[model samples]
Target: MNSLLPVPPRRHWSTWALLAGLLLLVITSFATLPLKWGDFFSADAVRTTADFLHGFAPPELSPNFLLKVGTATFETLAMSAIGTIIAAVFGALLALPASGRFGKAARQATRGVLNVLRSIPELVWASILLIAAGLGPFAGTLALALHTVGVLGRLFADAFENCPPLPAASLRINGAGPAATFLYATLPQCSPQMLSYTLYRWENNIRAAAILGVVGAGGLGQMLKYHLSLFQMQPAATVIIAMLLMVAAVDGLSYVLRRAMTR
Candidate 1:
């Protein structure tokens, strides 16, 4: 049979050539403009290496430091948990209207607002809250909440968007309003997925809370900063180890929650 369509032209090499030129520019900038590699690899590097090796080999066995770490870790967990909960609750509110399962006009409006809110990062929120609330876990919690609102809102919208249409249709056919259908039909179906996603966000927030202390938010990160400032490698190593263990535990919990949601 005769072909109805014309053959497409061969692709040009100019795009590939341009990409190669950009790659070369990037390599040259890094290799030349950044720093003198030889000097950077000298005595300063040796001192850094020495500091690294001394870490956790003997480890900090200080009872005071251990007490401090324990208290800070609890605060960090509370911050992350509260942050995840705030994110889920606010995100659900925003996601409900933004998902377009309701009226189109309301959906468009809600989505536009959510887009605006979610564009900002959690760290930035923490910075701003620090200014307003002063330095502490309270500020960190607020920061976590604001960022969680954005991240969880997007996930909430996705979960809502992917929900089966049958339930929604059944509710609509019965002349049920948006609020009623959502509470009865939509929430029941989407809750499991939403819970799983929230739990995962909690895991991430734990790490974030640790870092927020660098900005005076109060957590193990602040303790880390103190050890780092004093060049106290052993204590720093202990703090780092504890942080890693906590994050690992959160990861295990996330896996369990995800499986539960699936079941």
Candidate 2:
């Protein structure tokens, strides 16, 4: 009787159809592109690539060049740190309305603002701001802050909304004011998660900050772009190495912080 029990029907056709659609899209894209597949894989191409890469060996390690790289690395770090801090403060403020704590009208309005803010990429923001800021770390920092505010605001709102309601509910039942209830009950439970989200965004902002320099927004990317344009492969390599090290250090630090906070 157990063996004869009715079997549940498999419902995997939609997944298979989705995979097939993706495969077809990829094939179509490749077929339509004017790609030089043969030249890319040719022995001569490989040799040229190797020679170009080899030119970057023994990266410029002179004291002056090292100092420049160090300064740029610090600039990038500062841009990301400041940007994330500004975003965290503003994001928390925006989250209050976005989480529907105020009212439906406020939640909708704040969410719309966040959507507009995040819709524009950081690179685009930097490019636009470079005209006004005149090409420096300041533009880069603003770009990162603006984009991060949207991201963190949305994440923070979700964290607030998903917090255990019992605490806030109890506070209200005991005659606590709205501000008091949220401050004492709701904010405490979700603070760690909000912090974790901020840290994660900071990790991304570090990488973005480095790249923003390419647009003359200031930092390691500007150094890399300048050196590369002049065919100074050694110096470019040094800048690239600095970027990698800075990113790695920030990633490690953020990971440790997030772990500690979560614990």
* Model 2 error, position 151 (Å): 0.8
Clashes of 2: 0
Looking at model 1, residue 195 earns an lDDT score of 90
Off by over 4 Å in 2: 1-20
- Candidate 1 per-residue lDDT, tens place, 1-263, comes to 35867778876799789999999999998888857768767999889878778664777878998998888889888989988888788999888777876689988887777776667666788888888899889989888888778778878888888889799889989999888888898889999988988888888899999999888898888888888889888888888888998999989988987997798
Alpha-carbon RMSD, each predicted model: 4.7, 2.2
Task: Please tell me which predicted candidate would have the highest lDDT against the true structure.
Answer: 2
- What lDDT score is found at residue 31 in candidate 2? 97
Clashes within 3 Å, all models in order: 0, 0
Error of 2 at 105 (Å): 1.9
Consecutive 10-residue window with the lowest summed lDDT within model 2: 7-16
lDDT of 1 at 107: 88
